[model samples]
Target: MTSKVHLPYFDHLLELLKDQNQTAIAAFGRHVHWGYWEDPSSADGSIPDFANAAEQLSRRVCDAAKITDGLKILDCGCGFGGTIASLNERFSNLEMVGVNIDERQLERARSQVHPLNQNSISFVCADACNLPFEDNSFDVVLAVECIFHFPSRETFFKEARRVLKPGGYLAICDFVPLKFSLPFTHLIGKFLTTSVHNTYGTIKSNFSLSTYRQLAQKTGFITRIEEDITRNTLPTYPLVRKLFRENGAAETEKITAGAELVSKLGITRYLILSFEAIDP
Candidate 1:
């Protein structure tokens, strides 16, 4: 098991699930990331609403990957197999593999998500930066709101490119820092290192949009879609913070509040990016 990754948030979530916390299970049983709302104001801030919004976010990323019937897809950093389950329910005759570094998460994913709609679903315990697969193995690769926890974006890009078939899409959603706000965000991150570590565990949100393009060019991929949906995802913070507070994760709630502040101020933008694998 590749247990090198440290995610205190997941640990907390797992404990909550063990205790049969219905609200926690409803909000994060499947998806462990932020939610997305088409109309930010329409967000009801309820558990069911947040779960639906989270599903929408997964669909948005899958659409960006151009997934279709009978395609083989690899979802890296898959948390509890939420995206995979969504794909299974929507598409047919698809081969989907959900990979996560944490065995605990993978176990939950395997136990919860089953193949449906003529789709095949499997979970693998592996690091995103070091994929355990052959070259040209998948038609589409996805990383949904979990790239920040990766050891190295460049390495993960290379790995994704290696495993993807020719012209395959690599779609990911990440928290990208605005170019001008890099220094300020870095300074703040340094100051809140302990708090952030205790909450999210090993997040690297300092990467900029321009750097993503450059990385794609260097990793034999072409930028296909670069959309900033920060506003669409803003509704997630309040609900998540409320849940964290109710769950007695005060530090986590505080850290999440800080993230919400930066995102609202446009210092940190949530971006959905898709790149096509090209000939090397």
Candidate 2:
């Protein structure tokens, strides 16, 4: 039997198109770092039992989305269905579903989310840029911390619009650059890590908040909120480092150094955006 080999960045995505379910499950199983998915309460040694930041972000995004009961919600780039599980727990009335391009992650999501426990939840492997759902299928479409991987922001916005019902909403949480110069720390980190492919790699991505809002508006969605969560990420960097140290990951040392460098460089950080679908 011939063993499978990973393709290049974009080609890997195309292969995922063959069966989104399998792709998600396989990719997550092989690549995801579960420790990084820490609960916010457990984030810092001082912030005891606080709601997880990611969960809080998910909640805030949902709030920003203004979803109502019986609303069809699509979680684009829903990694291992974390957001889906979070939102479902908070709002049982919502009809929540998630889509990703990795099959391995989808498998974990299915296994973790019991069928009888929350029938409203569903996970499938699908591309974020080109969603497979029919037009106007959902009341809300959310892409949390995942849209950065999208090859084309415009296509992603268009697809989100296509799947969302009139008057529906869209929310995205991702990293954005603060200034023009490429931070040296990142370049150094990349050189240290096993290329961008083997680890959390940056791509031909843009970071300006203005650019994001402009893309959304140009793609036909009404951009609502552009929030700065940089402080949140910076403060919690230590916590993530602690978690990594506890887990004994070799990358812990590098991440700690990188965090310090990031702070010193004065780079603007990650953020979450909210938008609404409006037809002219």
- Highest TM-score, which number? 1
Q: Give the alpha carbon lDDT tens digit for every residue of 1-280 in model 1.
A: 3356778888889899989999989999999888889999999989999999999999999999999999999999999999999998999999999999899888889999999888988898889999999999999999999999999999999999999999999999999999999999999999999998988999998899999999999999999999899999999999999998988999999999999999999999999999999988
Highest lDDT model number: 1
Give RMSD to native, each candidate: 1.1, 6.9
Report the poorest 10 consecutive residues by lDDT, candidate 1: 1-10
Candidate 2 residue lDDT tens string, 1-280 = 1112221332333334345645233323222211122333435433322234445666766777886666789988776676777666666567778887776557767876643333387887777887878998899998877676667777988898888887889987765766464465356546755644443443433557778777777877888877666555454556445544543544544545564465545564666688888884
TM-score of each: 0.98, 0.74
lDDT of each candidate versus the true structure: 0.93, 0.62
Per-residue lDDT, model 2, residue 226, is 77
Clashes of 1: 0
